[model samples]
Target chain A: MRLVLLIFSFCDWLQRTPVASYMRASFWAFPLVESLHILCGNVPLLVATSILSARLAGWGLREVPVSKLARGLLPWAWTGFLIQVITGLLLFSSAAAKYASTRIFPLKMLLILLAGTNALIFMRTTYRRVAAWDTAEVPPLGARFAGVVSLLLWSSVLVMGRVLNSAVSLVVAAHLWFAR
Target chain B: MPDFLSWCQWLESTPMSATLRDSLWLFPAIETVHLFGIVALVGSTSILDLRLMGFTLAGTPVPKLARRVLPWAWLGFGIQAATGFFLFAAEASRVYLNPAFRFKMLMLVAAGLNALLFHVMTSRSAAQWEGRSTTPMSAKIAGLSSLALWFAIVIAGRMIAYFE
Candidate 1:
């Protein structure tokens, strides 16, 4: 837990410090980066969803060999996640002081932590067993569980990301209104 | 101007329905969960959807991809179904009244019933189209509807807030 806090603190710092001023100077690129992140986020979401619906009808990936499908989609999702993190940091850096004091900041951290943890578990527990599920002619419950967890967590992360800005604004608005 | 949507607002805020109003945060959180679930869902589904739209995996059999990825997809759908019910629970009255919500439900039903129809139609056709990289026109239509209806469902889901 301490280690997790420590890492988040460091991220909190970089996101605040604008330590690499050059990154901050490249401010014009933020929207482009963010849009790319949105694209990455949306496309995979579409694909991953339909797959789940088909499966519930008692079909496993082996029949259609979706193991590689897992492999195929991970990179896209990861790439999108990476872009969000980078640009997110950049946005944070541009206005570090304000966010540092905001409750919204911490909430973002908790959600990001969940996303990262979900990703790690996904690769280790779920992605690791694709071939075995294919070879054994049985879908491993562990992998399925991991898949379920991943689906839930990433969905949270995306919504959290989308709402983070608005939420912060809303909090600020409520604060200001209440203060008056 | 929008009488129905205004009715939705009244329902959401009914003092007698404090139980529902007090619980807005919970459903949104569940939605957050559903959001992630769909990520995994789309990841698995797109492979098959695209396959239905005629993109084939090299060497690996079509059934094989379907078998492997479908669980991940349905796992998402399952999470969605569970969470979806909660979201409705949170604002059941409002959702029941909103036009966008109605359309969303219609699209969901369309997607669901179409999915069942596709399965029945395709399973019979499986022997003929089975393992073939390219799907028949009907299967492609199924693929298209699956994609389109879900797209509408998501957009409506997202837009329900805005429209209301």
Candidate 2:
């Protein structure tokens, strides 16, 4: 109850921010920034994840050391994530109330949380043992499972993000129809 | 040009396009799949491009890296080509008129050409540079050019959604 209130208040606060309002009102700026967000944020992370996931599944670039590959790519993923968070927040703030109310929105967040958690667990456990299978073509079962989950979760996130607008419109239309 | 626009308009009016546009969920749903295609295509391509640029992943041979990622890249391209056509069919005339769409098409051509040329020229001599972190001048330039062009395409793609 208290926690839910705090969350709602935080969302309200975010919605009221100047950046949020600006994003909502500006036509060109919104789209341009959204494009930048995808380029700088999602693209890199997708690239890193695809490669890492592929490597983990023992499919691609079998010759490269897994630890080295992770080291090389994960930084780009982190950088993309940071950019994504900022851009995503700005986009969300543009219609915080609608987003906050949407079922898909929470689902999207949950999927993201799950993806992050999976990555964390993998890093702490299977990844810590990465040195053992650094040169092996196929990673251990745990690592492979993490890879598969990461791909599915992130892909679902992309799907959810895209459909969010339509979902909102549908909800609004339903409410208006019922009210009438 | 007017005929072409009419043709596009006709395409947009088709049952398929109508269904896509009219459904509350369909257009955005296709768009979501389109995005996944973009990720797969661009993500896979970038892996090879990065290897060419010698940015990272030096331990792996260049040819090997290319071999591994290119298939997925091709798969991504196929998905994008299909999904993109569907999206375009739904809004054909409008996209035809959109400067962003035009720019995106141009960039797509450029990116394709870059890849073709790299395969023909720079990648022909990949054997010499396989194990090394840094590629030859031509390969490096090809890689860098590809990255820039693809990034431009993504920017242009995003712009299309807004400008149209």
Error of 2 at A127 (Å): 3.2
What's the DockQ for every one of the candidates? 0.15, 0.66
lDDT of each: 0.61, 0.85
What TM-score fits each model? Answer: 0.57, 0.87
lDDT per residue (tens digit) for residues A41-146 in model 1: 5555434433442332224444545455555555655665666676666656654545655666767678668756755775676556566554444456655554
- Where model 1 places Cα greater than 4 Å from the true spot, the runs are A1-71, A82-101, A106-166, A172-180, B1-17, B23-25, B56-58
Predicted candidate 2 versus true structure: per-residue lDDT over A12-55, tens digit per residue: 99888989889978877677777767777888987788779989
Worst 10 residues of 2 chain B by lDDT: B122-131
The residue-by-residue lDDT of candidate 2 on B1-164, one tens digit each, is 25888899899999999988888677787788888887878887887788788786777788887887888889989999998999899889999999999999999999999999889885557777666776778888998999899888877888886784
Candidate 1 lDDT for residue B112:
84
* Model 2 docking tier (incorrect/acceptable/medium/high): medium
